[model samples]
Target: MSLFKKFPFKDKPSTAAITCIHILDEKKTILYVSHDADDGCWQFLCGKEHNIEDSRVVSLQQIYEIDKSIKKIANLEYGKCAYRKYKNSKWNVQ
Candidate 1:
């Protein structure tokens, strides 16, 4: 059996999502996940204050690879977001 299950995000693996350099640098795990209603774009954030220039656009697959826990909210609806207190914490939907 496959070790990882595929998520049904609206975008493809190659599709881009907004993220922080901290996540890409492995400095922090994603603490906030947002699915945009206007464009269906996703955002994986570290839940910290970062400069606008610190934002980066990375593929959805890349973000998934970074934090598999996000898969729990893969079915999150548009305009919705999920957050957690820590890496292993339960996601709180908003």
Candidate 2:
């Protein structure tokens, strides 16, 4: 059986997404997620700011590997954002 529930987002598993390189750091976790309304692009990020070079384009599935809790925000509305204080914290949509 799968460790996590299947993704609920409309985007495909191979869909391109923008994520901060910090997400690759062992000590860092994805605390924020955004679904742009204008272009319907997805962005996964840590709560803090990062340099332009810190950004990376990765498949949505790759991100799911980093933090499966993100599945909770898959249905988040366009133009909205979701954030949480910690990896295990409940996500708060904004």
Candidate 3:
């Protein structure tokens, strides 16, 4: 059984596990990775969860490669509805 199977949102077989982190700097600026440099859109560092571990190794590794000084301020997970909204409104903005 998958570790996330206990979570309410994990009931759907197609529900992908995503690890997201809010990276903050000393100046209080939030880090967002752009889909394309010229696209003028940005979002937090996130990765698909493929393992049972909670360390979010893949997402953390991507973030650390960008800036070692960036600290994790928050960790959040969105349900289907909220995630859809985010993907449509925030993430898809160009």
What is each predicted model's overall lDDT from 0 to 1? 0.88, 0.86, 0.30
Alpha carbon deviation, residue 18, candidate 1 (Å):
0.6
Q: Candidate 2: what lDDT?
A: 0.86
* lDDT, candidate 1, 1-94, per-residue tens: 4323365455678888999998888679899999999999999999999899999998898888888788899889999999999999999999
Question: Lowest summed lDDT over 10 consecutive residues: which window, candidate 3?
Answer: 73-82
Give per-residue CA lDDT, model 3, range 13-94, as digits (tens). 2322223433322222222333223432223343333233422223333443444332222122221111213222332222
Lowest lDDT 10-mer window, candidate 2? Answer: 1-10
lDDT of 2 by residue, 11-91 (tens): 888889999878876448889899999998999998887899988999998888777788888998999999999989999
lDDT of 3 at 59: 39
Query: Which pairs of residues have clashing backbones in candidate 1?
Result: none
Off by over 4 Å in 1: 1-10
Counting clashing residue pairs in each candidate, in order, gives 0, 0, 0
Q: CA lDDT of 76 in candidate 2? A: 87
Predictions ranked by lDDT, top down?
1, 2, 3
Best by lDDT: 1
Once model 2 is optimally superposed onto the true structure by TM-score, how far is the C-alpha of residue 41 displaced, in angstroms?
Answer: 0.7
